[model samples]
Target: MAASVDSPTPAASLNQEESTTGSTPFLRNGTVMSRSVKISSIPDPSLGTDERVGESDRAKRMKEDSLLLLRGFDSIAQNLSQLSSNLGSALQGARYLAEPPTLREIFHSRIENSESRQEEVEKEKIEGGKNTGLKRKFDPDERSEDQGNDFLNENEQCLEDKKLKKAKNLAVSMATKAAALARELKSIKSDLCFMQERCALLEEENRRIRDGFGEGTRLEEDDLMRLQMEALLAEKSRLGNENANLKRENQCLHQLVEYHQITTQDLSASYEQVITCLDFSSPTSSMMEEADNEDD
Candidate 1:
C-alpha cells in the first residue's frame, strides 16, 4: 500500500511539473484509463503522444494562432472603415443642406416680389387726399380719373401676365424636379443596400473567425461592439431615407427652375415680337412723335 501511494504521488508530481513548464507534455489518460476507474490498472496517459500527429505538424498551431490574430486586426479595420463611411455620409448630407436647391431660392424670390407688388398696389389704391387732407387743385398737371384707371388697368394687366408666366414656370420646374428626385432616391437606396450587405458579410466573417478561435473564451467588449453596430445600422437607415427625400426635393426644384426659365424665355421672345410689330410711323406715335416734335 505504501509503494502504491508513492507511485501515484510521482505521477501527480510529474503532471504538475509538466503543466508548470509547458515546454513538456501535459498528460491525460488515453483509452486505457477510459476502460476502468482503477488508477493503477491504467497505462501511460498517451493523450500527448507523438503518434496522434500524422500528416499535420504541431507547428501548425502557431500558424493558426497568427492567422487568428490577423483576422482580429482585419475586423478592427473593417469597423474603422464603417465608422469612416458613416462620417463621410453625414458630412455629405451637411454639404447638401448648405447648397440647398436652386428652385426653392427662385420660388422664394418670386413670392417676395409678388408680395411687394401687391403692397405697392394696395398703397396706391388707398386714397391719399382724404387721409392727409392735402387736396390737389391742379387741372392740367393732374391725371384724370379715367387716365388713372387706365394706368391701373395697364399695371394690372402687366402684373397678371407676369403672374401667369410665373405660374407656368413653377409648374414645369416642379415636374422636372420630381423626376430627378426619383432617380436620386433609387441610387441612394441601392448604395445603402450595398452597405448593409457589406456589413452583414463582415459580421459573418467575424463569426467565422470567432468560431475558429474556440469557444472557451468570453470575448472582451463584444456586447459593446454589437450595440454600436446596431446603432450605426439604424443611423444609416435614417440617413438613407433623409437623403432620398432631399434628393427628391432637389429634383422637383430643379424641374421648376427649368420650366420657369423656359417660360421666361418664351415670354421674352413674345415681348420682342410685339415690340417689333408696333407701328411707330405716325408723328403722334410717341417714339416717332418725339423725333418729329424735337425737329419742330
Candidate 2:
C-alpha cells in the first residue's frame, strides 16, 4: 500500500508534464528528461485558417475588379483619343471647305462691283431702250444731203450686226456660268450628306460606349458631345446653303461683266464709225455752213 500510494505521485507528475509540453515525457537511464521542447507562438484564436483563406479570396477578387476598372479607363481614353482626332479632322475639312482669306477679299470686291452693275442692269431692263444711252448727241444743222442716205443706212446695218454678235456672246457666257454653279451646288450637297452620315455613325458609337461603361457622368458628357456635333452639323449645313447662294450671286456678277464687256465694245465700234464719217466730210462745206450760221 505504501508503494502504490507513491507510484500515483510520479504518474500524476508525468501526466502534468505531458499536458504542459504537448508530448509524453520519456524516462532515460535513471532520470526522466525531456526529448523535445515546444515553443508557443502568438496567434489570434478568432481568426481561423478557413477565415484567412476566405479573406485572401476576397482580396484577390477586389484586385481583379480594380484591374478591370483600370482597363476600362484605358479603353475609354483610347476612345476619347479617336474621337478627338476625328473632330480635329472634321474641323480641318471644314476649314479647307471655307474660302481662303485672299479669295474672300477678291469675292468682296467682286460683290461690290456686282451690286453696282446689277443696278445698272436693272435700269437697262427697265428702260427697254439701251440705244437711247448709246446714241451720240448730234445737231440737225450738221446734216448734209451730200452724205449719201445709202451710206448712212449701211452704217446702221453694220452697227446692228455688231450688237447682235455681242448679245450672243453675253448669252453664251451666262449659260456657261450657270452650268458651273449647278455643278458646285451638287458637290456641296454630296459632301454634306457624307458628313451627316459620318456624324450619325459617331453618335451610334458614342451610345454604345456609354452603354458599355454604364457610368452616369461619362454618359452625360458623351451626350453633350453628341449635341455639339449636331450643332456643328447644323452650322455646316447653313454655311453650305449660304455658299451656294453666294455662288449664284457670283454667277450673276460674272454675267454682268460679260454684258458690260459687250456693251463697251459696241460703244467703241460706234464711236469709231461716227469719227470716220465726220473725217470723210468736206472741210470747205463746214466753213460755208459756219459763215451762213453767222450771217443768220
Candidate 3:
C-alpha cells in the first residue's frame, strides 16, 4: 500500500519538474505521463481512453497555435523593419527637398559652366580661322594660278561645311540643355509653392496648438513653439514605449493563459483517474473489512 502511494508521488514530482523546465515540452510530457498514470492506476480499461485521446488532440492543437504565433511575430518584425527603412528614406528625401540654396547653387553652376564652354568654343573657332587666313597669305605656292585657286576654293568650302556642322551640333546641344533647365526651373517653382502651402498649414496647426494652451503663459512665439514641439515629441516617444510594453504584456498574458489551460486539463484528468481508482477499489476494500471483522 505504501509502494502504491509512493509510485504516484514520484510521477507527480516528475511532472512538476517537467512543467517548470519548459512549456511546449512540458505539455507533451505531462499529457503522456497523465495517460500512463491513468492506465496504471485505474483497473477499468475503457474509462478514460477517449478523454486521453481528446487531451492529446488538444495538446497538438496548442503546439500548432504556438507555432502560428511565432510565425506572426516574425512577419510583424519584418514589416516593422521595412516600414522603418521606408520612413528613413522619406525623411532623407524631405531634407533634400527642403534645402533651396544647395539645389539653386548646383543648377546655377552648371548653367555658368555650359555658357563658359560655349564662349571658349566660339573663341577657338575665331582664332583658328584667323590663323588659317594668315597662313594662306604668307604661303608662296609653286603651282599654277588656276590650280591654286581651285585648291583654295575647295579648302574654304570644306572649312565652311565643317563650321556649319559644328554650329548645328552646338545649337542642338544648347537647345536641349535649355529645355532641361526650363523643366527643372518649373519643377523648382512647383516645389517652392508646395513648400509655401505646407508652411502655411503648419503655421495654422501651430496657432491651433498654441490656442489650446490658453493665454496664461507669457512666452515668445518661437520659444513657445519650440516647447510645444518638444512636448509633442516626448509624448510620441512615451506612447511608443507604452505600445511596446502593452504588446509584451499581452504576449505574457497569452502564455500565462495557455499554461493555466494545460494545468487545468492535467488536474481534471488526474481527478477523473483518481475517482476511477477509488470506485474500482471500493468493493475489494469492503470485502477486506468484512473478512477482518469475521476473523475478529
Clashing pairs in 1: 173-255, 173-256, 174-256, 176-255, 177-251, 177-252, 177-255, 178-252
Cα lDDT, model 3, residue 112:
70
lDDT by residue for model 2 over 40-70, one digit each (tens)?
3445567788798999999999999999999
Question: What do the candidate models score in CA lDDT, each in turn?
Answer: 0.68, 0.68, 0.67
Worst 10 residues of 2 by lDDT: 29-38
- Per-model TM values vs. the true structure: 0.29, 0.30, 0.26
How many residue pairs clash in model 3? 0
Which 10-residue span in candidate 1 carries the lowest summed lDDT? 24-33
Quality of model 2 by C-alpha lDDT: 0.68
lDDT of 3 by residue, 1-296 (tens): 55554356788888886776556876777787898999888766576797789999999999999999999999999999999999999999999989666434554566577668767966986796687667667764633564577577657656554544454444445445555655765785576567556557666878876786686544676587787667656755765675577567556555654654454354424334656756555788899999999999
- Residue 117, candidate 2: Cα error in Å is 33
Task: Give Cα distance to truth, residue 224, candidate 3, Å.
Answer: 39
Candidate 2 lDDT at 296 equals: 100
The C-alpha stretches of model 3 lying farther than 4 A from their native spots are: 1-44, 102-112, 115-296
The residue ranges of model 1 lying beyond 4 angstroms of the native Cα positions read 1-102, 125-165, 168-184, 187-259, 266-296
